[model samples]
Target: MTGKSLSERIGDLGRRLAVEAHTAWLAARDPRVAWFARLLAVAVAAYALSPIDLIPDFIPVLGWIDDLVILPLGLLAVRRLIAAPLWSELHALAETASERPSSRAGMILILLIWAALLAIVYWAVRTSPLH
Candidate 1:
């Protein structure tokens, strides 16, 4: 059995993931990294920062599509596309910035929720027997 407690293990995992994601962001700007790998990295970084989700989070079960499925997949792809040495170099220099690097999430979530409610209301009114 691994000696570390669950919380410690989780924290370690979180730090490692953070380091990998940060590496992708930094690697995107590095000329040494191949252009296509850089492009993929840039897309992953932009997606992680972008609040305009492909699937709205208000939906049941599927709301977390971007977070649970898309981002992880993108990260995995980035990890795959980048070379082992580059990843190793970047991982060693890891700095998981504490602050969120974007400003759009809260506003976007509010807007999406409002839009969903409005659509529901409109649908109800259009289908009502009282009409």
Candidate 2:
């Protein structure tokens, strides 16, 4: 292994992930990317930025697994779908961009989704025979 400490490596990985997510965000907005790839890119970027997860972080092992595995895999798939030259261009742009973008719209969408799910659960419980 390299001489760098574990914390240094972790820091580097975090930075790389940040750049990759930013690149995916850029690809999502670019018309040059295929429709399917753009859709996937948007999903990956939203999930990366959103506070909610498919699995709650309180769950043992599995919750952290999604963050560690699913995200990087999704980013990798987006990278593969994009042409090499285009991907490189986007990566460079992402690294150089002054401001890392935040998605208020994505946050709102996530909140709406959670609200709907909560409402459904409440309705179900209220209507249940055991209630």
Candidate 3:
């Protein structure tokens, strides 16, 4: 077993994931990256940075699995899809990037998505005979 405690290991993983996500964000915007890689990069970056998750965290086990498993897999896929040299350059830039980037557009999009889902739920509840 590694010397680090579980919490410490988890923290390190989180940091590494953040950096990888940032790299994907950078790759998505760069013309040097392949078109398919760029497409997946945009998705990975958006999902990683977004406050919402595909699986809500309140659920036991499965919720954390999505964060711990799916995200890392996505990051790994993006890394593999990118050429080695390009990945290394982006990773370096991501590590050195002092200010963590925020996206107003992403936030807005999430909000809009939530709003639409809420509306659908509300309509369903109102129209239901069991209500």
Give per-residue CA lDDT, model 2, range 1-131, as digits (tens): 65999899888888899899999999999999999999999999999988999998999999989989999999999999999999999999999883668799999999999999999999999999999
Off by over 4 Å in 1: 1-17, 96-131
Error of 3 at 23 (Å): 0.6
Query: Relative to the unseen true structure, what is the C-alpha lDDT of residue 111 in candidate 1, on a scale of 0 to 100?
Result: 93
Judging by TM-score against the true structure, name the best candidate.
Answer: 3
Rate residue 101 of model 3 by lDDT. 84
Candidate achieving higher TM-score, 1 or 3? 3
lDDT of 3: 0.93
Residues 1-131 of candidate 1: C-alpha lDDT, one tens digit per residue: 85999999868866666666777888898888889999999988787767778888798778776667788788889878888898777656656353436568888999999999999999999999999
1 or 3, greater by lDDT: 3
Measure candidate 3: CA RMSD.
8.2
Model 2 deviation from native, Cα RMSD in Å: 8.5
Give the Cα error of residue 57 in candidate 2, in Å. Answer: 2.6
Compared with the true structure, all predictions reach lDDT values of 0.80, 0.94, 0.93
Position 62, candidate 1: lDDT: 87
lDDT (10s digit) by residue, model 3, range 33-70 = 99999999999999999989999989899889999988
